[model samples]
Target: MHSAIPHLIELQRVDHLIVAVRTEIETFPKRVREADAKLSGARTAVAAARERLVNSQKDRKKFELDVQQWKDRAKKYRDQSGAVKTNEAYKALQHEIANAEAEVAKAEDAQLEVMMASEEAERRVRHAEANLKEDETAVTKERKVIETLQAEKKQQLDSLLAERERALAPIPEDLRELYTRIAKRHHGAGLAEARDGQCRGCGMRVLPHTLQELRRDPNEEIYRCESCGLILYTLEPVPVPGSASGSERAASSAVNHS
Candidate 1:
């Protein structure tokens, strides 16, 4: 009975490793996907900024073409006015020239507006591009970190699995079943310590008679915490608050009551 508790404790330790590694392995992909999503958003910003710059340039080009076409029309009208003989014809041609000049002015104003906006558009594209590059680098670094972590966890998983099998070798079938069921119910933590007449798992005060029985058959008897249903193991002579021996305190803290 004295040896059984150590075996169970050892089994629990191995199980903990297995559970932790498995959790990390499962969540790693989701973390990577989230990072990828951020990268995609940054890239979209760069593309949108570039598109704006291209559209602005296209608008400027169209305006310039319009200005040139109106200017040529005005010149042709002015030349035709020279060839006109009647005052009515001359006045009509002058009016046409004025209208053509106004069209040219409108086109020029539009061109100027596009030209003014082009600088800002280009600046935005550059800024977005820089941000994209930075985000890409960050994504790459995060991917590498994930990969390294996954590899390490994979190695650890294999080792833990082997250790778990070994840990199971000494336990009987009934205890194993109990351990498995309880562990599943308690997030892979099947056992808890009873200390200072209290169940550490659920903070329930253990009865004096039960505590005495637990001390008598600490390893042989299967003592369970009534409140939490965790298999209980006792550590006698609870450490004092300010005692020189801090080992028990440290052990208690590390115990996975949760």
Candidate 2:
């Protein structure tokens, strides 16, 4: 039972280490995915801007073609004006040519406006593309950093897990289960030292009888905090052999009871 005190301490340390490792592993990937999402949004914006630029350029070209067709029609009417024999007919043809010319001028102006707008849109597309590229580059670098960190964490966690498994191997199965349950309920601290007749975990005063029982043998039985359900170790000011503090004595007394 005395020998089991060290095993209990080792088991508690293992639980804490495993908890830390699991937390880091779980959160690192989320951060990486968030960075990826940002890059995707930037790329989508660039693509939308580029599509608008293309549509604007197409509209400009269609307007220019319409203007050219109207100009051709006006030139044809002008060339045929001499063939008209009646003065009324000649004046009517000239009026038609003037109207066609006006239409052509309006179309040309519309085409110019469209071209200017397309140029502006093209510039916007270029700017968006640049921003997207920059974001993608940043994402790539951040992902690499995340990967490196994850790898390092994984390596350390694996080593710790191995050590923890070894440390837990000697603990009796029932006691091990009890420790795990308490750890899960108490946020990784299954073992708490009894310090100056108070539970270190919750600062609750220990009953005099319980303190006397705890001081007998550290490894007799598993002693738990009445208030918090944590395994209790007595912290005595005096140092004992094979014990770091007086708490080991309390822990050893409990083991003896167990």
Candidate 3:
């Protein structure tokens, strides 16, 4: 690894977290809206049910009035039957009474139908009102959960931004420019770990000279992957278990697995 690679790696780490936090925060509003929509839908259903109930009540009242009118007409015809002097006039009065009675029966039937409709409307209003309370409670809980996650992600984003600034502070301007350009193309991964002669970022084979240069302790020469153009780095070897020199490892185990 070059002298400046560590700082860039740190910056990349912060940038990745920042991107993740911002992406997660972006979803919070939609989730909140979904929760609000459920509540709004419940409220609309209740309103519609109440409106139906009200209209059904009005219709029942109108049918009741119609039934009363037909009853009154039948009563008037019966009263007039006594004043009829001729057989034809009395028969006409009887016919009128029969017609009025038939109308009364029809009106009563219509009124009964309206009353049944009103009962159904009342039942729907009750059912809707019951669901409305549950929707309200569920929306409140969902909103609270979304809002809490939103706040937490915002805090994480803020902290990452500050840490990014600190990580950027130690890096040189040229390195920062290079890292930014490269990271933009690679989703915040500006550097690749060089291990087993391969670029970990892109799975491309690393050149022998570049790998050799990177394996040097306190390396100063900056090298990039020929295939992917990402700045390359190599991890120091870990000591084998119970080795005499804790600083070195066996040939087969000379690797930074982490």
Judged by TM-score relative to the true structure, which candidate is superior, 2 or 3? Answer: 3
User: Model 1, range 93-147, lDDT digits (tens) per residue?
Assistant: 9999999999999999999999989989999999999998999999999999999
* Residue 126 lDDT in candidate 1: 93
- Which of the two candidates, 1 or 3, achieves a greater TM-score against the reference? 3
- Residue 154 lDDT in model 2? 93
Q: What is the C-alpha lDDT of each candidate?
A: 0.87, 0.84, 0.87
Per-model TM values vs. the true structure: 0.77, 0.85, 0.86
Give the per-residue lDDT of model 3 (tens digit) for 1-258: 577888888888898899999999999889988888888888999999999999989988998898899889889989988888999999998898999889889988988998999999999999999999998988899899899989999998999999999999989888889888998898878998988878999899998777777877677777888989899888845334677665445443767563
Q: Where does candidate 2 stray beyond 4 Å?
A: 217-219, 237-258
Candidate 1 at residue 161, lDDT?
91
The residue pairs found clashing in candidate 3 are none
- Report the lDDT of model 3 for residue 112: 92
Error of 1 at 218 (Å): 9.9
- Expressed as tens digits, the lDDT of each residue in 1-258 for candidate 2 is 235557778878876877888899899979999989998888888989999999998999899898999999999999999799999999999999999999999999999999999999999999999999899889999999999999998998899888988888888888788888888888888788887889999999888777666666544776778899888866454335666666677888999999
